[model samples]
Target: MTAAAAMVRVEGLCKRFSVPRREAGLRAALRALVRREYRVVEAVRDLEFSLAPGERVGFLGPNGAGKTTTLKMLAGLIVPSAGRVEVAGFTPSDRRPEFLRRVSLVMGQKRQLSWDLPAIDNFEFNRVVYEIDPVHYKRRLEELTALLDVGEVMRRPVRQLSLGERMKCELVAALLHGPQVLFLDEPTIGLDVSMQLGIREFIRRYNAEHGATVILTSHYMEDVAALCPRILVIDGGRLRFDGSIEALRRQIRPLRRVSVRAAALPDDPTAMGRVVLREGGRLVLDVAPERVPEVVGALVALPEAQDLAVHDAPLEEVMRALFGREEAADLGGAIGHAR
Candidate 1:
C-alpha cells in the first residue's frame, strides 16, 4: 500500500547500539573503564513494511530478533539509528503530543498502574494527562470497564489483582484516550489459556468497534492464529515472510495430514502414506495433497476404518521450519515459495 494509505510506514529502518565489551576477570573490567571496548550490534536492519489502517498484523520473530525494538521505534519510545518511521501522519522520534495521543503501546512485563493505588486512580490520572473531556471520559470509562468486565476489581489495589485482572486494567488505561493505533508486545504472556482467549476476543471486538490498527508480537502461536490474518515473520533482524496463514502453510508444508480411527490395524499402512502416529485404533498419516483423495479412498475401503480427518500442518511447526529449526524435507515438498 502507498504511504498515504497506510497508518504506519517504515522504510529501510535500522537500529544499532555500541555495546561495551570486557573480559571475565575483575582486573579486565577495571582496565576497560579507562579504555572501554565496544562492539556495534545491529538490532534491526533494513526493515521495511507498512500497515493499512485498521489492519491487525502479527509481528513475529525469535528472541532478540528486533520485534520489540521495532515496536519501540513505532511507539516513539526510542530513536532509530537510520531510516524513517511515520505513525499517524507524524514522525515517531519527534514524540509530538498529537502523535502520542493517537498511539498506545503495551508491554506485557511493564505496568502503568500504580501498585499501591487502585486501578481506578490510574485511569483518572491518565484521563487528566490526556486532557479528556470529563463527560466523554466518564462515558468511555464505563464502556471499557463493562467490556473488560473489570468493574468489580477497578477499586482494588493493582498489586492485589491477579495477573489477568491487572492486564485487563492495563489495557483499559492505555486505551482511555481512544487511540487509533495500538502496539502490543506479548500482551498475554503469563495468562492461562482461558484468559488468553478472553483477551484475544476483547482485542478483536475493540478493533472492530473502533477500526484501530493493531500490531502484536507474541510467542504463543494460538494468539496469532486466532487474531491476525496477516503476519510479518522476521528473523536475524530482517523480514523473511509476509502473507496469510494459508499461504505460509502452502509454502512450508504442502502435505495434507489425514487422521483415521478404526477398529483394527492394517497389516501394511505404509502403502498408503507415511505413518506419522499410531495409537490404539487410531492412526495419523502424512500424504501429498494430490494423493489425498487416493489415500482416503483406500482407507475408506477398509471395513475397520470408522472415521477420517484431513487438515494442514500446525502453525507452530510451520514457524519452526520457517526459522530453520526443523529440516524442510521433514516438513514435506513444495518449498521455495517464500520471498
Candidate 2:
C-alpha cells in the first residue's frame, strides 16, 4: 500500500534507554552518590511494519521484549532514539496537536481517570481536553456508555469501580474524540473470563464501527488471538515473525492435535504420532500435519470411538515453541514449516 493508504507506518523504528547501573550494596550506593554509572540498553531495535485503517494488530512478546516500548513510540509517549514512526501521516515524536488529537492510548496497568473523580466527570474533562464539539461529544458519550453498559457505573468514583468497569471507562474516555488510532497495552490484564470477553467484543465492535487502527500489546495470548487477525512477534528487540496467527502456528508448531475417546485404543500410540495424553477411554496425539487425515481415520475406527477431533496446536504451544528457540534463530523470513 502507498504511504497515503497506511494508517500506521513504522520503518527502522528503534528506542534505547540509559539505565542507572548499580551493585547491590550500601558501599556501592555511597560511592555512586556523587557519580553514578549508567548502561545503555537497546529496548527496541530496527523494526518495520505498517497497518491499514481499521486493522487490529497485536504485538506479542515476553516480558521486557520491547512490545510496550514499541507501542509507546507509536503513541508519541516516548521518542525513538533512531528510525522513523508515522501515525496517521504525522510524526508521533513531534507531538503535534493534530497528531495527538488523532490518537488515544489505554494502558491496563495504568489509570488515566482521576481516582477521586467519577468516570462521567473524567469523560466530560476529556471532551474539553480534546476540544470536541459539545453536540458530538454528548452523542458519542451516550453511545459509548450505553454500548459498554456503564451509563450508571460511570457516575461512581473511579477508585470505587471494579477493574473491568474502570477499563471500560478508560476506553470510553479515549474514544470520545473518535481518534483514528487506538493503542491498547494489556486492556484485559486482570479480569474474569466473562469480563474479558465483554471488553474484547466491545473493542472489536468499536474498531469495526469507527474504522480506527488498533495496536495492542498483551500477555494474554487468548486476547490477541481473539481480537487480532494479524500479529507481530517481537523477541530480543527484533521482529521474529510477522503474519496471521494461523501462519505463525503453521510456522513454529505445525503439529495437529488428534484425539479420540474409545473403549479400545492402539497398544503403541507412539507409532501413530507423539502421544500427548493416554488415559482410559481417551487418547490425544500430536500428529504431523501430513498424517492428520490418516490418524483421524484410525482414531475414528477405534472400538466405541467418541469425541474424535483434529485441530491445529493451541496458540500457547505455538508461542512456547517460538520463544524456546535459541536467540540465534533465523530472522523473520527464514523460520518456517517446523513440525
Instruction: Please list the C-alpha lDDT of all candidates, in the order they appear.
Output: 0.88, 0.90
Compared with the true structure, the alpha-carbon lDDT of candidate 1 equals 0.88
Tens digits of per-residue lDDT for model 2, 244-315: 898888777788898899999999999899999998888999999988888888888889999998888888
Candidate 2 residue runs with Cα over 4 Å from true position: 334-339
Candidate 1: stretches off by over 4 Å: 325-339
- Tens-digit lDDT track of model 1 for 43-138: 988888888999998888789988999999999998999999999899999999999999998889999899999999999999999999999999
RMSD each, Å: 3.2, 2.1
Q: Estimate each model's TM-score.
A: 0.92, 0.96
Give the TM-score comparing model 1 with the true structure, all chains together. 0.92
What's the CA error at residue 79 for candidate 2, in Å?
Answer: 0.7
- lDDT comparing candidate 2 with the true structure: 0.90
